[model samples]
Target: MVTVNEAKQLIIANTQLLEKQKCALDEALGRVLAEDVIAPISLPPFRQSSMDGYAIIHTDITQKGTPLTISGESKAGQADLPELKPGSTIRIFTGAPVPVGATAVVMQENTARENGTLTINEYPIPDGKNIRRVGQQIREGAVALGAGSLVSPGAIGFLKGMNMNEVIVHRKPKIGLLVTGDELLKAGDALVPGKIYESNSAMLAAALTNAGASEIEVKYAADDFAATAEALAALIRDNDVVLASGGISVGDYDFVGTALESLGAETIFYKVRQKPGKPLLFGKKDGKLIFALPGNPASSLVCYYEYVLPALRRMTGWSDPFLRALQLPVRYGYSFDGERDEFLKAKIEGSEVVQLDGQESFVIGSFAVADALIYLPVHQNKIEAGELVEVHLLPV
Candidate 1:
């Protein structure tokens, strides 16, 4: 069995970066940029007004309530701006182009306009106030966003403002998920003998989706050697990464690991020195990556966060893909039972953390309310009330 760090390195070392693809701005959310996005034209391409008021030269407002004749009106989306003649001002709405020789916009509330006259009530309106200067937001040919940046919702609107319709980004991965077991049944199915409702498939699928894999294909195998082998082979050939939940341990029905080896995949690592998910299996073909996690729902999710998540990030060209982890003091003491390091489900409140109940691999009841996972090393038998421990924060 490999250590957790060694296991993670093995998975990352075998991952190959996927090729970049062009996508519309609407589809670019949560994707990493593959190239720099250069602005074709400056944002607010022309000097524009930011307020609905009178545009005037700053020096023209010499005293309080100084009157100036309104020359014309400039509304948003107008083709031409009426220029401000000497001793005159133009009424401009928000987002309207600022006329030539206009220095500021005195908000209508600050000015009293009757007939064609305007005045400044707000004393000493600063130069460039209420006006968005040309190229002020973004300059033409400037790097609007650098390569490797994550495209967020704000980025979409910003890119649109920069006149970009399409962008080159590391494409979201396509995943193939195989749920294996003969004793598993769907939620609505009847439970007979030792059969139980399947939950790992849903858990794994949700995790992969949260990790930004949009194209997911899920299937089930009945622990039969032929069925497991056929499903594993197809998944390996059809997806960027394959996540198989169950059948990885050394049981008579455990066929996932054997199926992977029979498919000519190079096994990177098998088990890890960790609790909850000790039967993890990682293998790779020439370029495709496969991870076979334990059958238990909680165990599968723990492995997904610790191992599968980083692999997805590496494939999609992320600089850092691991979960945000930090150390905090424990609020309760615990007795250790196993030699393997354990990732105990817990909640963090203020500066302290408390381990939750139901930490058994099959019990996911406590996991629902958990915000983080506390890491307890192998040799540490007890946790003092105020001892610091590392925590892996879950995605909110």
Candidate 2:
């Protein structure tokens, strides 16, 4: 067995980042940028009106309630607009390019139009009122997004406005999922006396997808050694990472360790000094990562968030891979005699952390409402209420 920190270090040290790929803006959300996105042109491309008003030279309006002839109209999306005639105003709409020689846009609310004539009810105060100057948002050929940035909705909109159709981003990893157990039954299947519904793959898949992985192939393996070994070898060859749940402990059907050895994979560690997932196993073969996780659903999830998740982020070139950790006071005291570090499913209730009632690995009721994981060290057993503890915030 290894300490939690040592296992985490080993897992991250062996991860290899995937290559970059060009993808359309529509498909770039939530992926990491592999290259800097440079603005091809100025954001607005031209000086634009920020209001549905009239464009005129500031000097053209000498006093309040001034009237000028309406010579032309400039609507958004119109090209090659004629210049604003001297001593006259041009009707303009929001997002419309400012006509040449125009110094300010008078808000329509302050202007009245009648008989092809315009009157400024109130004098505009500023020279560039209600107008967006050229290159106001970004300069031409400027860096719109730096490399290693997480592609978000705002990023997509910004890139689109910058006329970027596609961007280079780190590719999502291809994963192979294998579950081993003879007593497992699929959902909607008839229940048997000695069988339980298979849920680890579904939960793991959902978690992986939420973490930005898209190409996940799920499979099942029986308890037999031949079947388990064949499936493990196949997944290792076909995917960047292979995740197997169950068949790792000392039992008649536990074949994951033996299977990994048969496939020529070197085990970096077989267990961790942590609750819920002490039997977690990590291996590497020809640069491919293999995680043989424990059978319990909670155990698998805990291992995923603590170890496997960081590896996935590393493979995708994320600058920070770990969950958000914070120091918070607890709502109540806690006492434990275990030697392994325990992760308690908990939530933040205002100023303090409250550990959920059901902490057992097989019981997931509390996990449904958990927003954070309360980390309690093995050496320290008793912590009084309001004492500070480290909390790992889950991704919302």
Candidate 3:
């Protein structure tokens, strides 16, 4: 067995970054950028009007009620605009390019137009009041987005505005999931004695998808050693990472460890000093990662979040690839006497975190509503209300 920090360090040290790939900007959402994106052209390439107003020379309007001739109208996307005549104003719409020599724009609400004559209603029209200068948002040949940035919906739109059709990003990892158990039955099947509904496959699959994994293949195997070994070998051969959800413990039916050993896998760590997922096993074979998780549903999911998820993110080139951590106060007092570090399901209520019920490795009721995990160290046995504790915020 190894300490939690030691296990994490080993996983990080052995994990390698995947190769980069070109992805269309439309399909780059949730992907990490492998290179910086430079602006091809300046935003609002020309001086633009920010409001539906009249563009005029500041010197032409000196006081309130000053009248000037209306030359022409300039709408958005219009080219070959009429020239600004001396002592004259031109009607400009929002996003329309302002004509040369126009230094200020007076909003329509602050001006009165009678026939072709425009009168300023508000006095002292300032220069550059409503004009968006050239390159005000971004200049051409400038870095728009830096490398290692996560491409979001807003980022797509921004890149599109810069006329980018594609971006280079770290490719998502291909995963293979193997679920092992003989006493589990698929949902909607007839209930039989000594058998329960199988849920680890569906649960872990959903979690993997939520973490941005796209290429995934799920397979099932019985408790028999031959079947388990065959499934593990196939998954390792086909995917960059393989996750086996059961058969890692010391039970008589467990065969994952022996199967891995038969394949000559390098066991990085077999167990950790943590509650709910102490039997977690991490190993590598032929440059592929393999994790043998605990049989219990809650235990498997916890191991996925704490260990497997970080490895996947790191492989995909994320800079900080762990669950977000914070220090928060507990809503109520609690006590525990255990040598293992405990991760209790919790929900953030206002300013404090409240520990929920049903923390057993086999039960997931509390996990359903949990948005955070309150981590209690082995050295700390008791906590008082309003005491500070370490909290790991879940991605959900």
Candidate 4:
């Protein structure tokens, strides 16, 4: 068995960033950019009004009681006709360009209009206030976004403002999922004695999808070696990574590890020094990565966080491939007669994380409301109610 850190290194070492492709801006969310994006033009492109009010030269308005003649109207998308003269103001709508020689805007709410004239209700106004200047948000020729960063909705909008309709990003990985167990039944199937519903495939698939793997094929293998081998063989073709859950223990029908060896898989590591999920297998066959994970729900999830997520991020060219782990104070008292590194399902209570009750590795209910997991190291026995503990946050 290897330490978790060592196993993580082994898993990440094999990932190669995938090929890049140009995709439409709409489809770029969650994808890591493969190239730097430079702004072609300044954001806003022109000087524009920020309020639905009157635009006037500061010197044109004398006092709160004075009224100015309405010279013209400037609506959004309309060209500026001429400069504003002294003692004159233009009726301007929000987003309309400030007329030339205009230095200030008085919002319509503060200005009372009588016929074509305007009376200011507020006394003094500052020059050049409330205007979103040209290039204020982003300048032309500036590096708008860096490579290896995931594209978000805000990034898409910013790129669109810069007239970028397409971007180059790393292609999402193609994943294959396999589950092994004779005591597992598919949904809608009649429940047999000693049988449980198959859940690893669903959980693993969701995790892979959220990690940015766009394609996934799911399959299941029975306990028998031939059945397991046949199932894995049919699913592994052209896959970037294959994840097989269950059938990795010492039992006779724990066939995944042996069956994979028969298919020529080179094992990376067989186990880690972690509780609930110690039996994990990382390997490669025909240039495709394979993960033989433990069947327990919590174990599978912990393994996914520690190993699989980093690999997927690396394959997608993420600059920071590892998700951030936070160290939060424990709000609930607990004790561990530590023999292995244990991950306990937990929820955040303010800045502190409270470990949930009945956090057995196979129970899924405790994990559903858990927003994080607290790791307890070996050789430790007790944790106080207020002690700081490291927590791996679940993706929301």
Best by lDDT: 3
Tens digit of per-residue lDDT, candidate 1, span 1-396: 998889888888888778899999898888888899999999889988988898999888878988899899999998777678878999899999889989999888888888878777877878999999889988999999998888999999999887688999776778999999888889889779998988888887887778778899998999898899999888888888899999999999999988888889888889999998999999887588889999988898899989999889888877777888898999988878777889999999998998998999999988899999998877776888898888999987
lDDT of 4 at 284: 90
- What stretches of model 2 exceed 4 Å from their correct place? 61-67, 112-124, 349-352, 379-381
Using lDDT as the measure, name the better of candidate 2 and candidate 4: 2
Q: Write the per-residue lDDT of candidate 4 for residues 25-82, one digit (tens) a residue.
A: 9888888899998889997787788899988777656688668889999999898467
Deviation from native of the Cα of residue 31 in model 3, angstroms: 0.8
Indicate whether candidate 3 or candidate 4 has the larger TM-score: 3
lDDT of 3: 0.91
Top candidate by TM-score: 3
Off by over 4 Å in 4: 59-67, 109-115, 119-127, 379-381
TM-scores for all candidates? 0.91, 0.90, 0.96, 0.91
What is the lDDT ranking, best to worst?
3, 2, 1, 4
Clashing pairs in 4: none
TM-score of model 3 vs. true structure: 0.96
For model 2, residues 1-396, the per-residue Cα lDDT tens digits are 998889989998899889888988898888888898888999788989999999998887878989899989999999989988788999999999999989999989998889998998876557888889888999987888998899999999998887788999777888999999999999899999999999999999999999988899888999999999999988998899999999999998899999999889999999999998999999999889999999988888899999999999989878888988999999999988878888999999998899999899887778889999998888766899999999999977
What's each prediction's clash count? 0, 0, 0, 0
Q: Candidates' lDDT values, in order?
A: 0.88, 0.90, 0.91, 0.85
The true-versus-predicted C-alpha distance at residue 60 of model 2, in Å, is: 3.9
